[model samples]
Target: MSAAATDHEHALVYPDEPIYSRITAGKLAMWLFLLSDGFSFSGLLLSYGILRGSSQVWGCTTEAIAKTFGCIEEPALGINFTALLTFLLICSSVTMVLSHASMVEGDRKGALKWLGLTVAGGALFLVGQCWEYWGLFGLFGPHHGLIHEGLKFGATHYATTFYCVTGFHGLHVLTGVLYLSAVWIGTAMGKTDANTLEVAGLFWHFVDLVWILVFTFIYLIPN
Candidate 1:
């Protein structure tokens, strides 16, 4: 590169070089924010761990156990149902990558198509989450939802921690959905570049990953 091409962002910085690193300022800022957010999740999970470990009867797995703990008969988590939600998130990550690839390839319509699907996936996942919590009129199957099945929040350490961790992650998904929707609108208007979608992908993937961990610890772990 010639000195004529040099344009320093700061007097102390090398000409024609990034001030901080290879990533653009937007991406770097997002990474830093996610790091702090990660710490918050870690704290919540740690508290849950401490409580679960110290309690002799964290969750009532059987009638005899519930009787011993004097807990109302709470339904065991429907692992099959929650597993489907996890799969939905993982698939959305794939669509997000496709959308980025399509944008870079100059396929405007293709990018919008995949990106639209990605948004739909996120929306569907949120609906599924609501169904898990409240049953949503009991439309799908016999299950009437967790809360109605006796997993009310604040009733026990098990119930409270379950809602806190999963509910927090649910909020992230909701935010991701809205963020993607705005990006979709901007993309349609030619106001956004591939980098914008990539940043959105980072947040979406982060939420998906956190959900995986939350699933393992909160649902997969045995009482």
Candidate 2:
């Protein structure tokens, strides 16, 4: 047999690395990417915390935040809409994980179903954020120090810090939703199989982790 023929036969018999090994390479790359992205998010959150903690005016306790926002509209600890938003985001994370699992299990239909539910939850979360923005901008009064639109709010520092931090986080969430939408489209096109699902799942999980921190620091944490 010719040398070239033997080489060709070897290539055909020993098809490169197995799919599982290739999947591992993809997973490693994803983890590295996520690690860098995680650092970026951590920096943002840390900056927010440092600035927020330094602000004497925003030092109001959770009770004060609720009062200022008219959370209860009466007395009591009041039902904070931010808390509800947190819940929706957390629930969406669960649905996203389920979607990933369905895809891995070769249940494309199940994955689609869960993906739709996740998208709905993400929509609700975005709407809740809009309302929160309105509450801070409108009811809080530009002067109260949440929206520094035109120096109308007395403390530009406070409003600027609050808006910038929360708005940045919101944008991240929006981006994550878009990423999920793309994954869903790819799955629909039969372009994304189990391996693709795993990579996308990692991204989704990272988003959820960031949101958990944001919810705790921005809303649940007192002052």
Candidate 3:
């Protein structure tokens, strides 16, 4: 090539490229990954809404259903066990963010500490959910609830949809706990670095975000 042509090419290429530039390829990839995860969550919530909406007994009287459970408990559709679950998930999200910050500051100890706390929170939430399951199913014997009462009242379908919808969400929480625990282990073992933490944090936040919607639609909204 001619010297003049080579000189023109070099002039077109500036030499002062920023070493630590903003929005690198990796960060852009993370955003796209997060978007896919959001779609997954949206599908779950939308499917739930569609399934529950088509049910005839879902919007029936909660108070009337409560009578079958042999208790004076009112069906106040406020925050219940579901709200507690939401709180735990939110707490986990906060810990995950703290872990990310710790790693960014190059404090491996602090990062591990926060990761341990996050795992503990996840474990505690799982235990609470287990207890909740026993409470609902009456592990020692037959389950008693407005559900059984509903059956007697010819509202069997009502009980079915109620358990199925919330039970599916509980399963999601269970799976999320396991996923977070795995990430915690990797972070502790030094296998995951700041980038890994960032990716994990994105998933953790997505879980919490999904719970917010679940809590609102399933627990907060009155049927």
Candidate 4:
């Protein structure tokens, strides 16, 4: 065979690496994890929607005496408070991206600064969530004046789905915060690379994205 023909055959048999070869294995693994996690979150939120739709009433109103009059025949999940939590989470995503950017720029201090802010944002979000859950379930002490008595867990499908969905998301936020913290510590100790930071950022961003969906479907939607 001619040299040109042999070379052509070799080229065809040994193609270049796939496009995804540009992505580090760690990054690729993170994407795969996020994709599967996304499906789980989607299933939970879809189930919430179905349950809410089937229910005749899905909300409650409080009387002046701090008692729940009963389910309000509509969907309401404390939009104002949850909206604030959503905002915090979105802002954390911004910080996460900034942290990655700083790492790429070889500014370890800047990266640490942004990562610290991101962790704080996640921690704040968890605090707000715990407060919300406490109010709903009266877990720690006497029921707060702001929450109605009828809003305990297992009271209705609304309560069940609300806690299950938001509680799941809250767990993710907590995990992300702890994960970011570990990354930050590793970076500080010079044990972590930019790729590791980027991978952590991917998880943080996914957590934020899922919260936006949860906030919209669970908190903002009306029956």
Candidate 5:
């Protein structure tokens, strides 16, 4: 047989088209997982809304609330600081898109660089959350942390919902960081491909988008 014919015969075969709705199995699976995950967040946020809306006061900012609840007064959510974290996630989302674009363009180095930035952004956001919850290393600025000041989980509806929602989202950020790190390493070793990176990007993008909502409902909303 000719060399071309022999090589063609041995070439691996792939599905001629996507498994469903012009989407690959991997992408479809990720979408389904995201949908279920979305419901969890929705339930949490819905409960938060109902509680906050029905309550006479959301935060223990006033003296009467502090006295009535028998709980130490907790400050309102800090929009300024959380806003910074939001911006970081937004920037990370951009880097994630660039990473996927680079991979699609067959530029492995560019992909790696952008993906690294995306991971860093996620890592930093987690650290920021830590700083928000508890001062870093319990060193300087410890009192500013929510835990140190107040806002303890199970303390109040405001505090509980804040922790449950933001904490849940923070866990997602942490997961995304680790997930992207694995993909980053795999890509560096030449095992991962654009499709793989795209799936990771979908997850990272979902995380960032969810944070926007969390920040809005949990922080920006007037208490």
Candidate 6:
């Protein structure tokens, strides 16, 4: 074949710069994954809203006291506690972005520091979630049964939806923590790159965004 024809054929097969050239393959993959995950979370939140709106009562309980005393009925979900958790996640997102900035600037130590802070924030958020769960379901010591007999999971669809939605988001936070830890280790060992850290940041930020929706829909909205 003539050289000109060969070049033309090559250009047809692959443009000089593909449409996705601006984003690394890995980052593109992460974006696609986040898009699909966003859909899943939207569906869950939508279902929660539907169930919540239809339910007659969505009862909540106060913090767990001694086993003898147990928990008392409250006005709504522990909004104060959840609001704190939401703040933690938002702060972690800031640290996550700082980590990415440090990585881009070739500051390995700074990146690691920010990433560690982000991981800590995620861990704290998870701890808060667990505490809230324990308060609601009495999953741990002393309070072994549901906090309120009337608010039992089987008794109401609200209870079931609440747990399912929040539990799913909690699982995402847990997974994001693990994912960040791995990236941090790789960054420390000089194996991870800016793109990797940025992709991780995308996932972390998505988790934060989802929680905001959950907090608004599940906690702030009145039953």
Tens digits of per-residue lDDT for model 4, 1-223: 9999998874453223487556776788999999999999999988988888886555653342124444433224567877898889889999999999999999999999999999999999987887765554655466342235445667667777877888888889999999999999998998876788999999999999998888888777765
For model 2, residues 1-223, the per-residue Cα lDDT tens digits are 9999998874453224665443456677989999998888888888877877786545332566647754321111113666787678778878888988898888998988887778788777886676555444455433222222222222344444556666777787787788778888888888786666677768767776777787677656664
Best by TM-score: 1
Model 3 pairs in collision: 68-149
Query: What does candidate 3's lDDT look like per residue over 91-167, in tens digits?
Result: 88888899999999998888888877777776777666555444456753453444333322224443444455456
Error of 4 at 122 (Å): 0.3
Model with the higher lDDT, candidate 4 or 5: 5
Better of 2 and 4 by TM-score: 4
Model 1: lDDT equals 0.89
1-223 per-residue lDDT for model 5 (tens digits): 9999999875535455744534667887999999999999999999999999998778997678889877678876788888999999999999999999999999999999999999999999999999888877676554568887877899888899989999899899999999999999999999888889999999999999899899888888775
Specify the poorest-scoring 10-residue window by lDDT in model 1: 7-16
- Model 3 residue 180 CA deviation (Å) reads 3.2
Q: Estimate each model's TM-score.
A: 0.90, 0.70, 0.65, 0.81, 0.88, 0.79
**lDDT scores in order:** 0.89, 0.67, 0.65, 0.80, 0.89, 0.81
Q: After superposition on all CA atoms, what RMSD does each candidate show versus the true structure? A: 4.5, 7.4, 8.5, 7.9, 3.3, 7.1
lDDT of 6 by residue, 1-223 (tens): 9999998874453223566556766777999999999999989988877776775444544344223244334434767878999999999999999999999999999999999999999999997777666553554544322334344454456677777788899999999999999999999999997888999999999999999999998888764
Task: Give stretches of model 1 more than 4 Å off.
Answer: 1-20
lDDT: which is higher, 2 or 4?
Answer: 4
Give per-candidate clash totals: 0, 2, 1, 0, 0, 0
Residue runs of model 2 more than 4 Å from their true location after superposition = 1-23, 59-79, 135-154
* Candidate 4 structure lDDT: 0.80
* Model 6: number of backbone collisions: 0
Lowest summed lDDT across 10 adjacent residues in model 4 is found at 64-73
Better of 1 and 4 by TM-score: 1
